[model samples]
Target: MEKVTREEEIDEIEKIRMTLGAHLEELRRRVVYSIIAIVLCFVFCWFFKVQILDIAKKPHRFAMGKAGLSSELQVLSYQEGFYAYMKLCFITSVFIAYPFVIYQIWQFVRAGLYKKEKKYILLFLPISYLAFVVGGVFGYFLLIPFGLQFLIGILGPGIQPIITMQQYVSFVFMLTVALGLVFQLPLVMLLLSKIGIVSPDKFIAWRKYAILVIFIIAAIVTPPDPFTQTMTAVPMIILYELGILIARPTKKGFILLGTAVGCGAIAVVGVYFYFTHRGGEINVSNPYGDIQILYPGDRGWKKVSGHMSFQKGITLKTGKGGRTVLSTKKGVNVGMDTNTEAHFFDSWKMQLKTGQILISMKESEIPLEVDTPNGRIRMNKGTLNIQAKDIVTIVTAVNGEATLLIEGEEKKLLEGRQHKMSIGGEPVDIGAIINWSEGIVTKSDEQK
Candidate 1:
């Protein structure tokens, strides 16, 4: 009996070893194939490095032209350009070989998942690829241009902006890859929700915090400007909300309809605001020195002195030792200090392009919205001091109550509270609001 038991144990051990060996062989084979595919793609992309590089430089050139700066990009080292070219080819190869890599990964893991779960691979692969491509296109077309323009424009004409080939390529690669990963937010959430790891209700409840986090991420990743941060954050917020919609298990049809309608309404509103406000009249008053306005759909800057009504969507840039006051007919007052850049989206919405702006508004049926790099503030009959600097936004509610909306959540600020919000972290209380807004002028009591 003992001999029979020993033989059986030996046979079991042999079977287990064989299975492990087979799995190892399979993994090795898949890895080799993936490597071969990547190498082949790399060689192919290397041949078209010139064309790829040129395509990547388009946004930089466009931004430079818009800023009235030179279109030339420099190379600091002898091997810098060559290394950049290699980096470009490597990234392009990864993109081209992504499908094969995903396939190999799926093959290696397919046996571990249930038969029902395995079927999801077919659905996930193509959608994942499409998401990456969409994100890459967005980064290239919108994010890069807006980021470059804001960063360059903020120099205040004191410095000539010149970028290096290596730096620019590195920036492009990071932005595209980061956005590609970010675009996976919806898919990841759906997967987690399906697995019972996350639920729709939880996401909905966390929406406000999520939006705040998204803006913080945008501020950390992109340039320190409201426009650039907004361009990056809005899409992420939309995707996050969509993820919540997908996570819900009931009323799929209704949810889809509601999402579509909501999206359409937002699109319509955005388009209406963009077209009507684009090049519409704005009143600019310079208290001292000259003010330059970069009009919408125009690359060049227009000089303005004293009171002038220029088109909306124009960025008001104040010269050194210059102070400007801007007001719309709709009762919005903006006081800009020297070297400040501001953009009036409309009477209801305005963005502090750069520097500090003292905003005072009268009590009205509609609340005024001010967008900063950190988040958005909505208020009625309030005085708020908003300042945007590198990676930080300081907001002080001098008087009246104001709501700071981030990630869909609203935090109410009292008259004397000051909030200092940064890109990579939560808002911190930095003492009393009076300390920051003491001498600054605001609307009178009658205005409130």
Candidate 2:
């Protein structure tokens, strides 16, 4: 009996070793397939390297333009361009081949999962890819442009920006990839809950800490500014909420929860739209030089300094070399430039009668409406510089998106772009008047 028992134990150990070996072999084969897919994608991307480079340079160009500098990137060394191209192509290839790689991963792991669990994994594969693409697009369209603009804008006047190709490529690639990976937050949370590693109740209890950690992660991943970090953190918070909603005990429960959330969201949007047409009071402070205020039905403009609150129909005018900052209860800031005159229709809406004003909506998500002689400027978030002249209004989207309504037609004004329209409400092209890349010099040019 002892001899038989010993033989049985040896046979069991051998079978275990054989199973492990087979799994390893399968993993190796999957890895090879993924590598082949990546290689093919790399070759395809390399063929369109120039077009890819152009697409990559758009944000950099916009940033430089906003900074009132040239948009050309430098090549510090001859090999720098080569390496940059290689890195760009490789990153692009990875994004293109990501789905196939995920499919291979699913194939390798499916054998270990039960039939029901395998369905979940398969369903997640495409969704995972979609989330990654959404993250990448968010970074490319909003975060990258605005972050670069803020960083460049802070360098101030007279300091020349010397960005190199290799450095820029590396920065862009790292940021894009990091955002793509981080956007898997909700899916990761759901997975943890499903595997019993974390419960939904635990996630709810840890909400405050999760928020703190989310902001910290945003700071690490984004440019070192409160504006950019907050911009990144807001979406992350929403994703966390989504994770909680999807972490129900059963699929049916999740579906019911999703339906409720969808209805809630629609109601929220309706409420927001209704509030957009309403008005509120605003606080004006930090007056420098000569600042005058005219209240509703006032006989004369009163010259005053210090904090003051104004209701609807109040007008504020600044004299020569005068400036002041306006703030709202919701944390919107608008800086009135020298010799400016603005009339308040509401807390979120103002009319720039003349001169210039700089609006910063970084802390506020509420939309601000500025009515000028030329057109109407509507911005929900970002920094905007508006100069109102006698016959024209010049609006520059310093780091956010705005819409310019000209004669009932709305044209979107994007970051780093300027829109100049005449009093007739016609969109006037000013490409001939403003040289966006003026006064910018490279290191080589500076040396010369």
Candidate 3:
């Protein structure tokens, strides 16, 4: 009997060892597949290095245009350009092969997860890829351009910009990779929430602290300027808020309330647009006090009162007690509150230099785009209330929907939701929308 028991114990040990060996083999296989995918992607990116380089150089060109300087990036060392090209190819390859790597990782991890959790693996994989791409685009298009311009501008006039190929490539790569990782904010929050590590309530409670930390991070990552720092922080804050919203426990009552509010707000905006068919011009229906308008070639701001035509490259400023409302031909309306500064870069682009502006527009062929220190906002048919204060920009979607492009990702802001983005860094949804148009320069929120 003793001999039989010992033999059985030996058999059980052998089985355990076999299971361990099997897991190791599976891991090795996944690693090999991931490596193969990366190598293939690397070769493809290397082949298109010239095109990639051109694309990367766009922001630099834009910055130079803004600064009124024209120069090509230099190469100090004999192989500097070659090394830079190789680095770019490798980075691009990683981005291209990221999805396959994620798949391999998911395959390895899926074994330990339950069937329900397995669904998340599939969802996360695509989202991960999308987030990375969005982040890369954000770095390439917005942040890098603005940052390079600002840095060049601060150097003052007559100082020609000279950048090394290696330096430029490294800068671009660091910004792209950092943003790509940062854009994973939502996914990380969702995963933690799913595992019961964090909840929506916890995120809400930590709001103020999070804002502080976000700014600190922005200052560290971005160039030492309020604009760049605010830009970076805005997107991060928005992402954090989105994470909270995603993690929040779903409630039928809350959804119903939000739906009701959204419908009401939409109806109000629709009615306002229907009655006032004024083409893109400032409406002085009830001007609070006096305001100033500065034309592109004007020497100084001119005091204005009541109903002015909206023109491209026009600057509007409101004094301590002044208020104004401007509208576009496409039924796009902008209401500037007291102590606000706004510049219409073009018909489609408006920059909120400082203070608050409420925008309401119906879905049309022409999209109204607003630029702030944080990022860019594109609206079609939506009522958006944005406030710029210090280093933060608060955006609340009163009705319809708007798209926020920051850090290479486009986030949809739906009605009945409030989002806050750091003018320097990230973005977050702060929960239910409030009455943000209480004391607007245009029509009151209740009237709207």
* Highest-lDDT candidate: 2
- What tens digits encode model 2's per-residue C-alpha lDDT throughout 100-169? 8988998787655544566666777778788999999978977787678678766744366789999899
TM-score of 2: 0.53
Candidate 1, residues 282-307: lDDT per residue as tens digits?
57765688678775445789777666
TM-scores for every candidate against the unseen true structure: 0.54, 0.53, 0.52
Better of 1 and 3 by TM-score: 1
Clashes of each: 6, 0, 37
The lDDT per prediction is: 0.77, 0.79, 0.76
Tell me each candidate's RMSD, in Å, in order.
20.8, 19.1, 25.4
Which pairs of residues clash in candidate 2, taking residues 3 or more apart in a chain or in different chains? Answer: none
User: Candidate 3: minimum summed lDDT over ten consecutive residues — where?
Assistant: 275-284
**Which of 2 and 3 is the better model by lDDT?**
2
Candidate 3 has an lDDT of 0.76
